[model samples]
Target: MNRYFRLCIFFFFAVITALPSQTSASWQPEITIGLSQGLSGVHLSSTSGVLYVYEDLESKPILELPQGSELNVRILRDQIMANGQEIKGDQLIIQPGADGFIRVNHAPYRGYITLLKRKGLTVVNHVLVEDYLCGVVPKEMPPSWSAEALRAQSVAARTFALKNRKRHASEGFDLCSTSHCQVYEGMSAEMWTTTEAVNRTHGEVLFYKGEVIDALFHTDSGGMTESSENVWGSSVPYLCAVIESQMQTQPWERSVSLDALMQKMEKSGKPLGTLKEIRLSPLSIGKGSGDRSLSGRVRSVLFIGTTGSVVLSGNDLRSIFSLPSTLFDIRFRGGEVIFSGYGSGHGLGLSQWGAKELAEKGKNYKDILLHYYSGVTLEKLY
Candidate 1:
């Protein structure tokens, strides 16, 4: 729309994100990253803390785990079984069923273990019922598809985590398959290839001296890729620009070039194709990021500006969707937004393009990770 409107939306996101979450920070730990395995009852546990599962009420089970999947399990709480049984090492095996659940090897659910959950989620890393997204690939999906992309995702993410272990630089990287990144589910025919994708990527996000220098990826949403610095204020060496044809096929086309968008805007007053109303204020940060993609991609409402470059986030999104507001450590300067966003991510940290670039270059998964996440190294939790 107008430049004033864009500025208003930018300020809105900044203020909203800066505010406190409804739940205290202590209640929710920082960045609970959950790894979704296609199988039921099994999930990757990252970000040492408690776990919570995202499941629907009807299908929700008190205890849920994945079957045939292996994840390191550590007990956070000590419990004496009703039968007076004491567990050992505060650790339990995570056994899942084909139908989906964490099969309790020891009755009375012995203890609690820290597991990885989605971003901006609290309630001690737990299970995701329906949110554990897994579905068949569109019948129209290219025949060349073979779960290769998702496998690459796991490998890249894991590699980044591994190499950056020494410095604990886990900030930029995120768990894939969530709305924030890729959608991974091992069981579904669509996501069956995630394991192989990970094998291909090797979870390595390369970095220089602890700073994630490179990591590129592609999501079904971001019709195009993004520049990491523009989003997270850091340079992701490999993600300079993503080509259009390489864009993933998702309902929402994220890649909008300023030059190309200018043509569309010149004909139509709207800069973006979605044209969703947004609130540009800092007051919208902690309103539960409702109806949002699990990755916190949805905000009340906010506007995108026409400018050289601006970092976008969930809060900023509020301005476009007519949501509330928030204040964060980000700044949005309006120029000619020109519908330039090519991806749906916060556009920070690790990018899909950067990941693919590394993968193509024969960089092992771990080596790729070290290139992006600065000052970190890998350590197998198992």
Candidate 2:
């Protein structure tokens, strides 16, 4: 009997090894996004069919509402109340029927809606990663852009979402729906073009040395991108700076009065009373100098004032003055400090405008991605 059992086990192993490897369709991972937080109450409705409400971890539906039915959820002390009735649990999951979508405060969203009472009522969306991207790509980039550009944006967004999946874990979700995470407007933001891009690049991600990359992106890169070390003070091999050969410089200018600057400094807890002079190196593109990054972005600035002088980083200045970018020249004129800069964002990773230019020049999405993210491989995770 032992010999027969061993033979059966050997045969089972052989059959298993002989079968082809495949990722199951159901293996698609879901991402939870914090839609709203600290809400006293929220309204929900079904868009197409019935909506099933379930308590956390329960398969059976606790409440069901037909089409057009509305439910009001609120928090009282530590309890969850729905439609004037107190729910037994602190969390409630709302799932839609076939081809149905749930609307939270009139904004329709794909996948299940979860309401959790943490401090106050929090609304979350539990959506498949791909479905989430459909809402993201359009908001991050114009849906009217080239197909390849859209496709590239899709991959980058997906990789970014996956890499930062636990960014808001302590806040009870994977990410937020604002620009702090990725601007996600749910079903309302989905477009046919951008959705196609997400579908075409489904399960695709940018990987560096077997791991997914952060895949940071921005609005424009001016003429050159900055190294990760220069921007975030950490060296990432795959995030090395690259020059956009076909791209032209995008220049911007802003001015702030010295008095305004002093007030801003005081508000920021760094009281620089009566600004006397601004000392910064002249702006030079694609080269690093003292107080400047390799991409010519201001790394630090020496702010001289009458009361006391304090040196501030370029990012701090950007926040204080609402400047477009850190790559700028500071000049004192009359009662105002003029800031003339290039680019629009942090000047790291993929530049959206640069991608559009490349796509218009006949480069595919892969080419665009490779040009921005050095030494990375595109892999289909699913």
Candidate 3:
């Protein structure tokens, strides 16, 4: 009986080993990020594990420092220098500590980091794609939200990161930790719920025609979402208008003087001498008419000024006024521009609030993604 049981166990192990593993080394690629720029120096420290610094692309590390060692890096005469030693290479790679975190200029980050002297400063914080996403998920969405919602968010964020990987190529980094790219807070913003969400949907991304789509998202969609052509001047097949019943009504009211409005426009490079009259053409919540998008979001508005009347898109007006969204009504009354609007953000792709509501109502992450991004397939890239 014992011999038969051993034979069965051996066969089971052999079969398992023959099958392919999803998370192979080649699938998980390391992602480079420029954490901080325009810095002539950086101070790093690791307490738990030995920090290895590589000055070249060689297999062996040049400096294997002890734990809790504080190292300072600087640039001198257009050459990289570390700890007062003239390093040969233009970059230095610092491996993460045994605790899986490294301190860069007092802030902790997961995975390895590379320091490079570029232009007038040092570029810091290069990390793996998964480690970077762990910091991004919690900062982008509430960690306490439904698991399904967070999981959807994880996939969307991952897709966005991969799609825009070369956004900052000229700046010597793939992406920045700001709204321009994706808000990454590093180890300081790590949350267990968000981390689990990222792990649950690891390497999963939304793809259209075998290419990763720009998985844009926003806070709310008011009543309807807009197509990509109307909002961003590109007609994307998957980013079509759709009504979101789960989203609540969000109204925003603001008042600004005509002088202030003119000043704002001037700062935006559109110098209108003086404001005369503001006309707003109204459209239905789900229908576009005249200068509005298919979802009734403003596409363009005519601004009557003393010098000359200039036409601007609703998105442009939103930026000048710091409004939440382009869906708004404007009226010039008593020398003040009274504006009232609904929803928030660009109203382009997935609605984060809509996802939360759907998750609460028993919808899974996959369902939420399909509802927002139509005609797209969820693929496991790594």
Candidate 4:
């Protein structure tokens, strides 16, 4: 071959090698989510095809039911009973055939179902990570929000799920299907807009120093976000406090009578006689003081009473009173203790409302993500 032809072949091979590998293109991880626990019985069905039932430890399917068939699974002491038939194993896997989804108690799920016997019958959904996010994004944020905001939520939710994949391992699954993990409503909750966002940012995650960061997020930040050390008591470099470009505060107020406040404190195991006064600095946004975090969220409050006194953290007060957030001002007026606050949820990482505002202002998903999670690189891990 001529020298020019040899050079041409060399360049073509180099180009082929530079392209993404097949493994990367097809990389998809499965996530196991605990749907419900402590159930005496659950009804199972398939959307469009046959359902195959198998033991968790066996490869061969034990039973198969036609499309539109229903099976009632119940716990019989330590064994599982399917449609009154006693199954051999303690765990049973219900898989749908063809392009179908399995329904647990009339709710459609993307992947197969695993029914395990714990304290009671535990139902878990085994779904692909991307498909899981399709359910999560719509539930976490409004599906009608700007495309960029949905995409940002997708990345954050994906990173969080992959990072905390083993969160509920002891419970026989990876994560739970509640807000405590990530509110996953299965295929029924998947929307076109959110699914599109998930597809656009497929396999993308936020990484700090080559490791996936715990992408914690919240509903709204009053004006600024709080650091990990402030909210969770551990300093995470990427989870630092960041002020929103457009500070849109969500104001809220709740009033409890002095007698009611005392009763609440007593119910929480801290008995203060008669409410005296609440001591804390004034509300200062983004300015840390002795009693507040950098975002001005209460660090601790000195609760004085006639008989005894107690110092409670802002989080403590929030739990005690069911307040929206810890960023609040406590004032004693008349016979009541009034709590005036701003924002919802624990102010950490990405602010959902803040993301929506930024997206409306033409900021893309990457820009929104970097704005909240500091010093993180957006990479397509798959």
Model 4 agreement with the true structure over 280-368: per-residue lDDT tens digits: 99998888999999899999999988889999999999998999999899997898889999889999899999999899999999999
Where in model 2 is the C-alpha error above 4 Å?
A: 1-25, 57-59, 246-248
> In candidate 2, which residue pairs clash?
none
Comparing 1 and 3 on TM-score, the stronger one: 3
Which numbered prediction scores highest in TM-score against the true structure?
Answer: 4
lDDT per residue as tens, model 3, 1-382: 2434533553454334221211113335455567888788888877467777776545577777788787888888887778888887677888755654678887888766778777745555666678889999998899999999999999999989878876887776778888888899788899999999999998788888766789998888877888998877888998888888743358788899988888888887778798887666875688788888777788888888888788889888887778998888888789899878788989988888888888999999999999999899887765
Question: Which 10 residues in a row give candidate 2 its minimum summed lDDT?
Answer: 16-25
Task: Tell me how far the alpha carbon of residue 101 in candidate 1 is from the true structure, in angstroms, after superposition.
Answer: 12
| C-alpha RMSD of candidate 2 | 7.1
- Per-residue lDDT of candidate 1, residues 113-212 (tens digit): 2222323211121222111222211211222333433433454444333322223124312243343433333233333444344334332334343343
lDDT of each: 0.33, 0.85, 0.79, 0.86
* Tens digit per residue, CA lDDT, model 2, 1-382: 2434533553454334221111112446677899999999999988998888878533677788989889899988778998877898778888788768889999999887889888889898888789999999999999999999999999999999988876898888889999888999999999999999999998888988767799999998888888988778899988887888643478888988877878889988888778877789887787788899878888999988788889999989888888888888999888898998888888889999899999999999999999999999888776
- Find the candidate with the highest lDDT and give its number: 4
Residue 241 in candidate 1, Cα distance off native in Å: 3.3
The candidate 1 region of ten consecutive residues with least summed lDDT is: 121-130
Backbone clash pairs for candidate 4 read none
lDDT of 2: 0.85
